[model samples]
Target: MTMKIVKTLFLKAPPEHVWKFLTEADQLALWFHRGAADLKEGGDWTLVTNTYGKEGEKMCWGKVLEMKKPERLVHTFTHNHLKGVETTCTWTLEAVKGGTILTLVHDGWEKYEDDPFGMAANHDSGWDEHFGRLRRVAS
Candidate 1:
């Protein structure tokens, strides 16, 4: 298997608008989990949610690896709940006729000694949930 969860979405918003939802703490919470802080290259980040149990409990944590404004972003990521495994999340945004084409490539499941495929399946569903929210908010 390729060991990656790849998804592409068409957002009815400009690249700049989509960028904020991905990087800004407040903007992120509008769609995905609330970010601990704005994401920037070379900086650490954590996504937390107050819904499941305790408030501000971390869902994911990672370091921003690379970013090229309104275009590309790459980060080292890991779900805190699935400890001992780290992966990478890469996002690419391309301007289109009416909006932006956003692509996500989440990989690095090769590190999972126990159940890589199962984890990939769970994450695939998780991303779909977030993406659905993003589409609605960004519209």
Candidate 2:
């Protein structure tokens, strides 16, 4: 069975502003990781960091599968810890009364069926921690 992680948060910013945080390397570094995103369909994106483990930097990369500006984005994602497994991440932004409601979904854990739940749990917490930082940055 496939597993997925979904997270949603209300950011005290417009969708356009939140889009910048996700697409621009400098803005992304303030909360997520230092990285560059091509921001077009089929384009490439990479996020690199030294904070997760050991001394050297680790990298996560993917291709932009879809882009709808300040509305939605879908990408294929893979990281070192994923053990060559690839997944997909989708971000949806909705304009609300006070700000933007951001929803994130990461799917395709069936590929890691050997330990699906364990891997999902790890990523759940990781996304939570990162979203907390994103909240602060987007606010």
Question: After best superposition, candidate 1 residue 93: deviation in angstroms?
Answer: 0.2
Per-candidate clashes come to: 0, 0
Candidate 2, 1-139: lDDT as tens digits: 6689999999999999999888887787888788754366788888877475642354888889999999999998888778888889999999998899999999998897568788889989999999999999897
Displacement of residue 5 (Cα, Å) in model 1 is 0.6
TM-score of 2: 0.90
Where is the poorest 10-residue window by lDDT in model 1?
77-86
Candidate 1 is scored at a TM of 0.95
Clashing pairs in 2: none
Instruction: Say which candidate scores most in lDDT.
Output: 1
Q: What ranges in model 1 sit over 4 Å off?
A: none
